[model samples]
Target chain A: MNLKSPREQEYIQQLSIDCVIFGYEDEQLKVLIPKLDFTGDFWALPAGFIQQEEDIDEAARRILAERTGLADIYLEQFRVFGTAKRSNKTFMERLVALNPTKLDDWGLDLNTLGWLTRRFVSIGYYALVDIHKVNLQKGNIDASIQWYPIRELPSLIMDHEEMIHIALDTLRLNLDQKLIAYNLLPETFTIKEVQELYEAIYERPFARNNFQKKILDQQVLERLEKKFTGAANKAPYVYRWKRY
Target chain B: MNLKSPREQEYIQQLSIDCVIFGYEDEQLKVLIPKLDFTGDFWALPAGFIQQEEDIDEAARRILAERTGLADIYLEQFRVFGTAKRSNKTFMERLVALNPTKLDDWGLDLNTLGWLTRRFVSIGYYALVDIHKVNLQKGNIDASIQWYPIRELPSLIMDHEEMIHIALDTLRLNLDQKLIAYNLLPETFTIKEVQELYEAIYERPFARNNFQKKILDQQVLERLEKKFTGAANKAPYVYRWKRY
Candidate 1:
């Protein structure tokens, strides 16, 4: 089959980017995943191909911004998923075979279908956002994207579930840096709020005193004004992540 | 100029692996780098192409073993360097032009010279090993690999110095987990030895009491038999990384 296709010509054929947008709300951790409507709720991380001259991290940020209109995201390049046969030939090619009209609409022909079967070295970047803050309006983004509680992730497509798990593990491992980097929390948050964030991330409870002592000892947070709840004597102090 | 080359057919073309071997000695941190004889002082990290059927991590381990001959070193995939023009085409092409006889020795032609200029998304893995323990023998490995102190590195080719810097930053950020994963230390070590390792890594001095408290708080180490100096009270307790 001929390799030339004007539609795919603008992209770097061998490289792709996937952005895993993670969210935390109500003491539970979540991830933003898209469900492809044509494939009956087939889910995957929002992915995009890179332009010829673009940097990989810039491509990731572009993809993330296209999917979610949120800006000022701090994206971490977590891992490169580079298995030689990572693309599922049957899933993609069969979809094309089953729906020839869809193929035409997508500007893909029998020859350009090679794009589906060829290898891609995907660079994965993950960003953290507050779940309550994310109000995704799926206007221009073609797929239905939603935040799924990580533990209750629906069936995902083509090793995406594995990617989510790895992203979460990376998120947990580098929680302090990530949380500070993204400013995911309020500027001044109570120790209880910090503890809730930890509980959600770790999916376990921590002893209040030990967790508080550990956070304080890290010296990353500076004590600020007492939390104004109108309880004068019993008010707890709110702190901000010290900017350095 | 046709694409067929029996010499270059076995490997994955789009992906390659570069291993950064770090060493700590005498309160200094060093990196293992190789100098290419063809391009004078053309230093690159020891890199190898991954085979089509090999797993990425397995490929990294294989590359590390082949270069270092050390089997048990733990390799960490730190980052993926994926700029489109990452390959230095003029340098490589000029070298080929200048030395046609050398090209014949390496079994390369114009077609396979495309191999030198093609876009590659390189997966980077960094490993830590004791400087004293690494005795590199240049038997099968083609290049002369040597350890240079992180600060004193010579001119490196094609963004390699940047790679080395990122690898060192990653090494410092993930020091505890990395130190435990590789078993780069002796089976047992003293607090002073641990302090020296930290100083080498951080390139700064840490107060004895604070450093000891921080290490102990991590609780990854288990106290073992005391150093048999026969001084009794003064001899420090040696410890091993606790097996979980």
Candidate 2:
């Protein structure tokens, strides 16, 4: 076999971006994942390929808008997974097993498949959007969309679980700056709900008085005059994020 | 061309790791960069290629030792840069200009050139090492080594300057943890030195009294016996990290 010239190699393959969109509500951590039209019943993170003209960051933002129908929320790049095995033979094997003739069976081109499975150096960005802000959509196939609590996350397509773990670790470490206050609760919530959110994350209950001191000290919440409906005592004053 | 078999098409190229080793000395933040011995003039960060059996993290540790003879220091993966132009045509152009047929002239394997210029996905780990702990070595052919204060870094070889910037940003954001402190000062130092180090990073002097109160309250530092540095004025008391 004649050796391919360096220029002919053309082996620098396509790149894609994967997003692990995180949200918190009802004291449960959640990730916004979607179902693909092509892969019947299979769920995957809302990911998309980078266009030649787009920066990776922009590609992620565009993907978020196209898939979620919500925009202008804050997102942060946490990690980039670039190992050669990122999209290894296992991915192709799984695809082939689903349908041996699926290359043409699905609308996916062979070149597209190669590009899709190319040594994808994925940039993982985790977005903290208010759960209510998410107007989820099924990507070309599924019947309905919903937020799956992270603990019950489905078998993700690739190393997505690892990506979520990384994002959560980053959030936990930077909780003071990137407060869970905005991302995890309802727009208008009672103090009990706020305490529940922290308790869920800390995996234990915090002293009510101490937690109140810490939260109030941040000056990120505004106490409302009205109380939540049907509460037991004094209807604990409702607190809203300073700028939901 | 007939499609290359997947096994044959999958090229396991070389992997290399580089560390943006940072230190603080004399109220300035510095990085340990190498003055290349090959060119005998150009400067670059200390880097070495990964050996076949080593993990990427191990490769970083090995490279650190080869360049600085430093071991068992804290190293954290801050980012990975895999830009198509990280090793742009400039390197090849320089090499080709230096010797029209150097591969043949020096009996070097020309195959190495393809790999050298091809895409490299480098894992960057930033290390905090006490400037005193490093024993610099002329580890590779034609390599000279020196420390460059980050603010005045010389022209670097590739995306290394960007790597340093990201590392510094990571350090700055994690100041509350004081994770980067142990790497900056001696095993024992005065509160003044600690304040000076932070000032160097902050790029402005902090109120001495306030700085002391804030830092000491963190409980990560333990005061030690007075240092007799032979300097005047009531030798300021020394302190060391408690290694919690």
**Among these predicted structures, which one has the highest DockQ?**
1
Q: How well docked is model 1, in DockQ terms?
A: 0.40
Q: Tens digit of lDDT per residue, candidate 1, span A5-101?
A: 3346667665677778887766677888876645445577788777767777777777777667776676888888877677746566655656567
Q: Weakest 10 consecutive residues, lDDT, candidate 1 chain B?
A: B1-10
Candidate 1 all-Cα RMSD? 4.9
All models, RMSD in angstroms: 4.9, 7.7
lDDT of 2 by residue, A135-207 (tens): 7766553444568886787776678778888887877777777675466666787777888877765567899
Any runs in candidate 1 off by more than 4 Å, and if so which? A1-9, A93-111, A130-143, A178-182, A186-195, A205-244, B1-9, B93-101, B104-111, B130-135, B139-143, B177-182, B209-239, B242-244
How would you class the docking of model 2? incorrect
Clashing pairs in 1: none
Give the range where candidate 2 chain A is weakest over 10 consecutive residues by summed lDDT. A1-10
Q: What is the lDDT of residue A240 in candidate 1?
A: 84
Task: Tell me the TM-score of model 1.
Answer: 0.81
lDDT of 1 by residue, B1-244 (tens): 1112334566755567888888776566788877665644567777777666777777887777766778778678899997767764766776566656766775766566677476666888988775666668442424577778888997876777888889878877888764442245767778889888788777899999998998899888899865466665766788888876
Model 1 docking tier (incorrect/acceptable/medium/high)? acceptable
